[model samples]
Target: MLTERFRFLLNRFRDRLWVKPLAVCLLSIAVAFVAKFADGTGMAKFTPQISLDSIEALLSIMASSMLVIATFSVSSMVSAYASAANTATPRSFILVVSDDASQNALSTFVGAFIFSIVAITAVKNEYFEKAGLFILFVLTVFIFGLVVVTFVRWVDRIARLGRMGTTIEKVEHATAAALRRRLNAPNLCGVPVRSNLEGLAVYAANVGYVQYIDMAALQIWAEQSKVRVVVAALPGSFAAPNNILAYVIADSAERTDIDSTAVALAFQIGGARLFDDDPRFGLVVLSEIAGRALSPAVNDPGTAICVVGTLVRLFTLWSEPEPVGGKQAPKYDRVEVPELSARDMFDDAFTAIARDGAGVVEVAVRLQKALGALAASGNADLREAAEYHSRLAFKRSQNALSISEDLEAVAKAGNFKTKHAESVSSSDGKQQ
Candidate 1:
């Protein structure tokens, strides 16, 4: 439970551009003094003596060059982030910013710069003996090589970082991971709540979206209070001071013993939704990107079509018989979590695209085909939702498309999805 909370915090902080760089800079400063400490080992007598001037000159060059590179790295990343937010969706900004290669590149440059400055200053003050200077020189050379390699690798990535296709790919991967995690913990490893919980309500303290649910904490509280903890708002659900996050169903008529404050803390609230645990958020963001592309200003039907294909792939993941690695058995026995609704997911993924791209024949046709694939999925819930969306998209297109041929085209695709769904259901029935 603590690990999950810590992981959410870690991921949240890691996305910030400065965290890694700041950490690396501090480590570099510490490393700068490593040689001085080693000089006390009496091993200096066996080391080769090197001139301090060469080391100082090398350090000076690195110190100057690294600062420039670090600044440039930040500038480029900022531009890429802005581009991703504008071209794709603001929600995708974090994924682009959290690119491992980009962060590593920025951290390496800043770390090298800090190391050089500390080393050069110490050398000028005669802080290191001859052996220490030689050791620092070796370290400097290693750091320099690292900088060069990182720069080379980062150059390739920065070029493609914020492009529409790149951002879409990043969002798709995030969505898929979230979907997989959902598969593994459909009920947050808690018992499934089948009916309305009759209990004392624990209201959220904040006005924001539900981010993380500490199920373990809820279970602990439930055990202590001799009550059942029924989660009312899952991750991605909106939270308000007046909204109940969870209901504590206790046998006792007086529920004064239950710590309502502690129960409320289990539901982590944030200013906006996150993709880490909220698969629906990811789907919504993907739809937003497609919706933006379909806007009159962008008028990019191809991008919308691309998004349709991506959505199809993402939705199919939910139909997998088992999670990729295997699912962990439910652990929070006393805590009950509602099932993630398949209908909600379909709504998040397709509603915006169908609404915004209704007039674009190409986009509407692509959407229909994508829904068709889902309509035939083995998962009955997915098939049902897909068929629903297919009909919805077709109806919307029929209203928006003025041309007879365009309307007929979308209708044909929707008909195909319905027929295919029936055939699949019949086949399954025959096999049974």
Candidate 2:
């Protein structure tokens, strides 16, 4: 719960524009203070041999150059976000937009510019004329060096930020990470909430995707009230006044005066679902990209195949065992949540791809193989989903393919048994 809370906070912090630059400026100011205070100290002996005029010139040039670079970078980033939404998937725009590298790059540039202005102003005003000259000079050199290094790194990172392959990889990695976490804690580390239990229905005041649930807070409330809280809708569910957000179960009299507002506040509703807690959303976004690539206008089957492989990798992890944690029991014993269904994940991931790529033999083949591989994972749920999708894809491929050879090839792969094996199996069954 604490980890989740921290993750939630960290995620929120990372999405903002001010935090990084603000911190950078604060650090710059601190350095300036250090330089100012070190003025009269013998530490000036270590200061590099540099003229104040040269330092001012360097700072002035950096401040002006960095401003232009920052502006260009922002524009470039905007274009990339637009291209990603149009070419790849709109859901991916968020990841690309919140990219740490891009944000850090921009922040560094802006921060550097601010640092330069402050230092230049201080130098021109004679604030460090007689004292702290060495400290100021040294710090200015360091800042300039940092700016150059950051600019180089930023240039490299910006080039790949919103490209289709990069976007797909980003989505896949995010989804895989989320899936791994879910594999360890399917119910978000809460007690499994029962579906059949009837309790007091709690309604959400707004209509939007449930972005986050403060489970720790909810658990505290449940413990304090001595009642079981069944979360009817988990994060990523669309909630409105009409929807039941949760159910409060009690043994005796109902606590009518207790405001459900606090319970409502626990859920953070947003305009759209995010990939952080919703692995399904990520898978869905990946499928959307494949669907786009397979469109007649694009005809990029290779990308679709690549996406199929990525999905296979994810589901393979899904079939693994829940990672055991430490001896400490889950903190939210009273709160219940449902497990994400493997079938639904399969549906969200492959159903559209199967529908869109039906005519493409290569895609069909790879999809069948991916499903077949998943079927072999031995998790009954995954096996069932794989079998279901394999048959559906097979039927579509049968209709889509005009060539008998391609149809036969796809069917062979889908069956998990080639013609020879099928004949041998028939003979064995008959003999038995």
Candidate 3:
């Protein structure tokens, strides 16, 4: 099985771009060998009395040049392939199979070996009179090749680092914006209008009051009144304006109360409640409602002002306060949570399975911890909001555990079943 696996891997590798460099190296060797044989056998040797020693020396030089080129090509190809593969696939597999430093060193050694052979052959052929000159030439080639390789690798590293920094900045900005929106409860005035009912739902959820508004009541109201009471917004959501998010029965007697209540409910839940009837009053009412809810916690107009001030500060800084509230009043600090790419997450699960064996308690525990942290810090409310998200996380973890066990079972079964069948077939054939 191992031999077959190795053969499969070798075939796959031979199809990669680096294989071209390997082919070139082999071709160079073959050409040099054929030329030497042709000259020896008097097969159209159109040379001006080329000596055997001189011919050998030229072959050595060509071989050295080919080796250097091959080494550089292999190093570049391996680095590019590994980086690209890591981006697309799992880092765990890449870590298991290859590393940048080792690949680089191997390439350099191969090139150095070829250079050494050339140096020895050149010295033997008396290409230079002084031994020092030969030594200098060898040293020069080695140093030059090493420097060039190192520089390329360094540039590649820097470029990757730059990309990582930019990604981190973007994540920080998004997190900060989200935190600010949550904290400040900014009045959505002159904002591009989107769906109002959806906006109301989100606002309700964010302010920990969405459950108060009966969904059934709203639905009943919509049907009885012959008005489309569309939810322009949901709880924990954002919107922009002239966007008719919700439409209600504008002609009904209860229309005034329904729209008023809807806007009032939306304002109560950290949303800007603006209407054609009274836009500024809507803003004042929303502010008063949010302030009254938060006032219990901070208990002062100054503190309320501070909370609003914090939102602006967070927005400008593009950051949030750390979980561990520090002294000197919690200041916003940029946070960069490493985004677990699909490959990274898969690799984490793979590594856990491979090292700890299947059905391990640790895997479940780790996953639980991860989910818990996400719940605690990820703008999620366990009591009145985010029940759906919590349930989804639980289901996902359960599924992952099940999948891990299945994979383990399959791996344990292996190709032994195939071998056993083959053995039975042979035994029957012999009996016949």
Candidate of highest TM-score: 1
> What's model 2's lDDT at 343?
85
The Cα error of candidate 1 at residue 122, in Å, is 1.5
* TM-score of each model, paired residue for residue: 0.93, 0.91, 0.25
Q: How accurate is candidate 3 locally (lDDT)?
A: 0.35
Which candidate, 1 or 2, has the higher lDDT? 1
Write one digit per residue (lDDT tens) for candidate 3, span 162-205. Answer: 13222223223333533333233221111122323322221222
Q: Write the per-residue lDDT of candidate 2 for residues 273-363, one digit (tens) a residue.
A: 9877888998999999999999999999999998999898888878875545622345689888888988888999999999998889889
Which candidate leads in lDDT?
A: 1
Steric overlap count per candidate: 0, 1, 30
Against the true structure, candidate 2 has what lDDT? 0.82
**Residue range with the least summed lDDT across 10 consecutive positions in model 1:** 416-425
Give each model's whole-structure lDDT.
0.89, 0.82, 0.35
TM-score of 3: 0.25
